[model samples]
Target: MTMEQICIRLVKVDMLSPVRALNRFPSVIRCCASARTDLMRTNSSSSLKSRGSVTAAASSLCLRSRSGLNTCITAFRPPAERVPLIIQPTREFHTSGRLRALPAPLIWMVLKPLQKLIAIILGRSIRKWWLALPPNKKQLFREWTWRRRWHFVGAGAGLLFFVSLFLLTHLDESPVTGRTRLLVFSRENFMELAQVTAEAYMEEFKDSLIAPSDPRHQVVEQAVRILAERNQDIAEISSVPWTVHVVDGPTINAFVLPNGNVFIFTGMLEAVADIHQLVFILGHEMAHALIGHAAEQASLSHVVELLSLILLTAIWAICPRDSLAVLGQWIQGKLVQFLFDRPFSRKLEAEADQVGLQLAAKACADVRAGPVFWQQMEIYDQLRGEPTIPEWLSTHPSHQNRVRQLDRLVPEALELRASCDCPALPKADPRVIFHQAVKLLLDNAKKQENIAQEKKNEKERAGVILPFPQSPPVLTQGSQPQRGGVLATSALPQTLLSK
Candidate 1:
């Protein structure tokens, strides 16, 4: 068959039954190609034009059989090379050579299974962990979750309350202290209370026995006096009326009452061996009063206590009473002691130490003695085998720590002591002073005992005696002479005059 006949037959086969074209075209094409075979095929003008330059392409085409020729013509035009069809959507292509426009639903379809798998894994892990936990632990976890929810709610309420308070109230600064302290109460009221309390204390304890004029007393007194004088030079101290009173006590303690009333126990005198050493101890106590530390501490504590009470009340209201009651009390106590009191005390102690050293220097006392005194205290504690007092308990720093701080202040103290022109007093004999003190104390005790006896006698007489007049009145209310009257009032007076 000729090329024209082959092309016509392939097209006719394709058009007639396209499904069987692949199977029958090879044999038909081979038969058409064979010189001996006489298979006739037909072609149209349109088919000849579409099969571009068939004469040139016919050289390349070899028909082994009529069927192969027909198959090649029908199924193998340009190999239909599967060249990744580029379909442009509405959006532009990305620089990454990927299409910018993705179908939203398709993306969701791809990610949905992955997301579900991740969720299933997390859920299973959590369930396993829950199952592995002890029963009590699981219960605790549940309780903790509930507690956290309540905590957040409480926090929100507290924040709202504070915000409202901030909006409504006025914040006033303290005038006397010059620090910007919160003045919730009027200064007048505070001053009035402090003044009344001070007066009552002084009046009640005016005769509270002081350490007699012993060597220790003189040392302590001199030290205190110098500190007071030095402190007076400070502008803050100038307005305060500083007074020192050395009380007789066995406990090694010292305190500065709010109104600059300093009371140093005799026990502290025994602890301090010399005037220079005594000054450091006294100076520190004085600083507490000078700086109004007590007032500051009281104010801070009051605020903390108030807040704790509010929280405790709220806890009681919301939770099971028995369950949370112990916890609430524990939290409240810890808040009061550690959060409020301990921190305030520690800070004040440190501030007092700093200020006291300055005061001691100004007072022209031996600043070096400060560290020596603390060292001595530490040594004494060790020698006695007594447990060192905690800083929190005594509102004072540890001896070792205080000594180290004092060491830093030595140069300043020495400079001040050198600059001063005042002559030092001669040291007294401790033995003689101790004896005198002992005698004085004994005498005072005896006096007290006598007074008590006199009072007891009077009470006994009152209890035994009848409430009756022993003698008649000489002057009647109506007939009594005026202020210038010379008339004798009683028989005994008239008899004595005649003699």
Candidate 2:
């Protein structure tokens, strides 16, 4: 066709949008062209205007150069060089120019199916996937959808019920701090577990026990008695029977079980340069029991166990992939334990340190010695040259972290000690304490994030704690058509959710 006839034909094509037509037709569009083609194709109104003042004229089409595969399109030129069309050709370096048009009927057929496909898959591609599934699978998908839509409501109600049950049934107050605590197990239960662990330890080390006549054994026993007697006055502390033993081991360690069984390694005794350090260490171990650390740990573990069972029930009902569901169950359980349980464990340890200081200061033991004792432990850990575990991995805070924490509570401890008519102890160097404080602040900002903050993060990450503590995840294709939308959180551990 002649060029004017071709332009009129293009303008008459109403099925394609301007933009779509421009994109679809890559060559041979009529009425306008690159600079060289402009002289022949452009209207006469443009002939008077200089190139710098080129203007929009009514003649129109955009053509991509077939020879170079270069795209050229029209733009308004001030509408000001106001009467001539300007075509800017964005080109490649091929030294050629040519054009041709594909047959419109052929183009229409080729594009129609593609356009329909695009429309079908726009943001709902998974619907097509669902339709492609087996009849059994489609039923499963619908069931999952129904559960997701409805289970969230049920889970919310369940969580509120369980939380209320916990608060009402397990209300126990902590001594010294006077804060109410939720303790699912009784002190008697803790005593039983403690006795079992203690008996096992005694059997393992019976031959290596330090003789009661030994001066070291005598000193440890006396210190334990003093600290225990002071802490026993607290209402939270059960008057659990106390038994202190010194093991003749090189490992510098001491610990107390939930029941009042205390074990001190000879290495720890030998490591201490002074009696006060030993006294503070004793207080720390005792405080773990006094604060009901074991009970709190048991409570969390029990909740996770219960939640995991509920999760598995939901998984069995929702998941079509049998093999993958088992793997997912294991992963989610670990994640719940790691993300939700471990941080609380660390918090318990930190809480013990605080209460230990109060207990030691009240017992007439100089609580200022706690930092010095922890510093010694840090030095010992250094000599072993074991790789330092990162805060996220370790159950205990680094010794430096302990010392920094202790430094903050020193003034209060000292004041408590004075109130209890305990002997005055000299404070440590201000410069050293100041440096420790600064380091801890930096470490906290950089690494030791508050656990609450950690849990608050990554709600979208897999293994994220579902708002429902024991509620099975919603498995609806409507909410999570992809394999991992909700159940993935339950299967992955804290590590997956961490980043």
Candidate 3:
């Protein structure tokens, strides 16, 4: 067979699959060699004709698999006469003729280990340059860097100025409180993000969610409605849509989405002492939504991440050893969390408390319930025997601190309530009532324990066991009781028997 015939068979084999083609490759090469040997022997007298046929056959196989096949085929031909394939798969990954080539700028990044290569090359070059420098020269270089240190400081200061300007430009006042906060994400964007989180929660608690017809759902809806309808001062109460979902679990928690979706757990219902406390809880969550705390926190987190990333890069670039770089990063992360993240979170929580109190007051839902709710929470925490995390380490203010802050804001909240035409609050403070109720329950429990203990002590002192009482004899309905209190069914009066 001619080389053309062999090449055609090879194409057919390759068409089967790349792996099959590779597996059959050696067989094909052996066949080709055998065919070449046989042809050479048979056509030894016709050298010119054989060479012409071989050249034509090689040309036919060009561009079979683009560059790879072309190069393989060209090995059989003289280098001077070899023709380069126009379409090279090695140069561009895409095989389709219709699709445009990938962008030139990205080709180096996509097709090569450019970053690794650059890092390796730069590291070795720096090492070599540093080693070549004499001790005196190195000392002089250090002194020079020290002398020019102010330039580096100025550069850092300039960067800080720009960052500060950026932050100032993005600062926005929170609703109701008018406290300025970093808010890079707009309302629409944050709501979109919040929608994802809401969906995730819905999916997670799909089986546990309370139906709208459920009383739990109704209670949450009623509370939310009261707050939204009566408290118009909260700008977001009217602007954003509100939704209520109750999860049937004992989480003792309620949270609000940025899009004004409120989730209250049944456990939270059981935790609150009354509707007034529930109202305060709902107001607190709603305040989180109204102030756009989610978006503000997200913006702060993004800024923190950016700053951390820059610090990490500087650490990695400047540190002499990888271990030192890792250590620096660890310390940097903890510092950022303590100094910026947690404190910011606590501040937001405190602000939510203050604003939530105001919202509850405007709704005429017992403003004192604010501090009372926190006080009850503190008591519950204490009763549960759960270890409390320190305030600085926690993302929320301690319950004690929250109670104090709410107490301070109560007078102002009461004034606001009065201006809103709300009815006068009852002379009875819910805090005192809650404390009294808890104390009464505890006292009753203690008295029950004391009574049980006294009975046990009296039994022990008597030192005599009581015999078991015998059961009364079973009797028919017609049986009459005799003087001895024993039933006498068979001995009836003779006159009654005759009748």
Best by lDDT: 3
- Whole-model lDDT per candidate: 0.54, 0.62, 0.68
Q: What's the best-to-worst order under TM-score? A: 3, 2, 1
Model 3, span 1-499: residue lDDT tens: 7664674455444542333453457555444433444434444333211322345434211222433322122224445663332111222254666754443223432534454344435544565577778999999999999999999999999999999999989988877877878887777776666776788899999999989987667766877887888876556888878999989896878999878888988878777766667778888898888888877887787777766665665666566766776687688879999999999999999998888888877777778877877776676666555688899999999999998898899989889888877766679988788679768866776666677667667776798544432222211122221111001122322311221
Instruction: Indicate which candidate wins on TM-score.
Output: 3
Backbone clash numbers for all candidates listed: 19, 9, 0
Off by over 4 Å in 1: 1-191, 199-208, 211-221, 388-394, 412-499
| Candidate 3 global TM-score | 0.62
Tens digits of lDDT, candidate 2, 127-148: 4455468999888878888879
Candidate 1 lDDT over 1-499, as tens digits, reads 5664664556454543432543566555444333112222222322321222234213122122223222123122233442121111122233666554433333444665565345434444555566678999989999998879978899989988995585347344433234555434443344445565566766766777565465445545555555666556565466667666667666677776556666777677666655555566777777776566655565565455555554554444444443565576677677678666886687778767767776766676556556666665665566455676767666567887776776776666556655655344235534345447547755775666677667667877888643332221222223221111111221112211121
To one decimal, what is the Cα RMSD in angstroms of model 2 from the true structure? 31.6
Ranking under lDDT, best-scoring first? Answer: 3, 2, 1
Give TM-scores for every candidate, taking all chains together and pairing residue i with residue i.
Answer: 0.47, 0.54, 0.62
Residue 84 lDDT, candidate 1, scale 0-100: 20
Q: Scored by Cα lDDT, where does model 1 land?
A: 0.54
lDDT of 2: 0.62
lDDT of 3 at 215: 62
